[model samples]
Target: MMKIRDVGHAIWDRPLGRIVLLLVGGLVIAVTVMLYPPLRDVVQWFLPLGLIIWGGSRVYLYGRNDLLSLISGCLLILGGITRAVFQLIPLNELAGTVANLIPVVAIFSEMFAHHYREQE
Candidate 1:
């Protein structure tokens, strides 16, 4: 029988274990979204909005001191606005794709910027 401390040490010691846990969690969420149409729709509409609101709040709180946060937050807010506007308008699929990519690219850019800055 494994002790609680042993289990905690295993989790902390193994990065692969953390990755596996995250993957399993993601799979469960994916399955749930696919099985439930209402949930799928709600996630589709609200997840980006939630990201936008969260990002905007972060910007308001920390943007003054951090340039990367400001840029990322603006990108998130812009992505959300574009997504919402696209939903309202009957536009082409490409526009929708761009709107979706905006936040993802912003996140990646922010991560890269931070990593580069840390190396300096």
Candidate 2:
């Protein structure tokens, strides 16, 4: 008795729509993953990239009077290098990644450094 479009609008415009969308996205990814093999080297890039991003975040705290952050950041950087070595990332590509992250690092650093300072 109800039109399909009316039903879609009722269900898809509510807060529950977000959860339904996530489930649908996951199902699509699962089907696609079965069809296409993941690239190992591409997957390996995430290790160093994530480390660099996280370490850069801690390193930024140095600007806000946290020396411990510098220490932790240095440790994380070392860990990233170790991960890159283990993951077989080429030096050239690693350098390129670091270069690419320069602006991203600055933005994240600034954002997080003052995030707590702003009051709601």
Candidate 3:
């Protein structure tokens, strides 16, 4: 006999649930971007909060070996440190955007790695 997984409590056990959550998060970000003025001023306010929540959840779910979570945590740390320094240094905003994207690319790269690892 095969075992069945419980749905109500095992939300993270399935990938679809995760996809839905990601989509919802993206929607929230999109809405915030479209509807809000003073977004740059607010981004630092919300991003750190979001980063903490995201990193904590990922650590809880996947432990330290979760590449995505690890990358995110590193990215948050780097961004925070850079932002603090740049406030005093006044580096190019475009450069900051590009620097921040390193983590985004790392995330996608790791996602692809996970996908291929699963296929093996």
Among these predictions, the greatest lDDT belongs to 1
True lDDT of residue 9, candidate 3: 37
**What is the C-alpha lDDT profile of model 3 across 6-104, one tens digit per residue?**
553376567898788789988897788778866756765565445445445545655476665565555555554544454446668787776566546
Report the CA-based lDDT of candidate 3 relative to the real structure. Answer: 0.59
User: For each predicted model, how many residue pairs clash, with residues at least 3 apart or on different chains?
Assistant: 0, 0, 0
> Please, what are the lDDT tens digits per residue for candidate 1 over residues 1-120?
999989978986899988887898889988999888678777777856876896787588768977877887787788778777776787788987887788788677567656755776
Deviation from native of the Cα of residue 106 in model 1, angstroms: 1.3
Give all candidates' CA lDDT scores. Answer: 0.78, 0.63, 0.59
- List candidate 2 stretches off by more than 4 Å: 1-34, 62-64, 89-120
Clashes of 1: 0
Model 1 misplacement above 4 A: 1-13, 113-120
What RMSD value applies to candidate 2? Answer: 10.5
lDDT of 2 by residue, 25-94 (tens): 8788666666765844455576677776777777775635664456556556666656666556455776
Order of candidate numbers by TM-score, starting with the best: 1, 2, 3
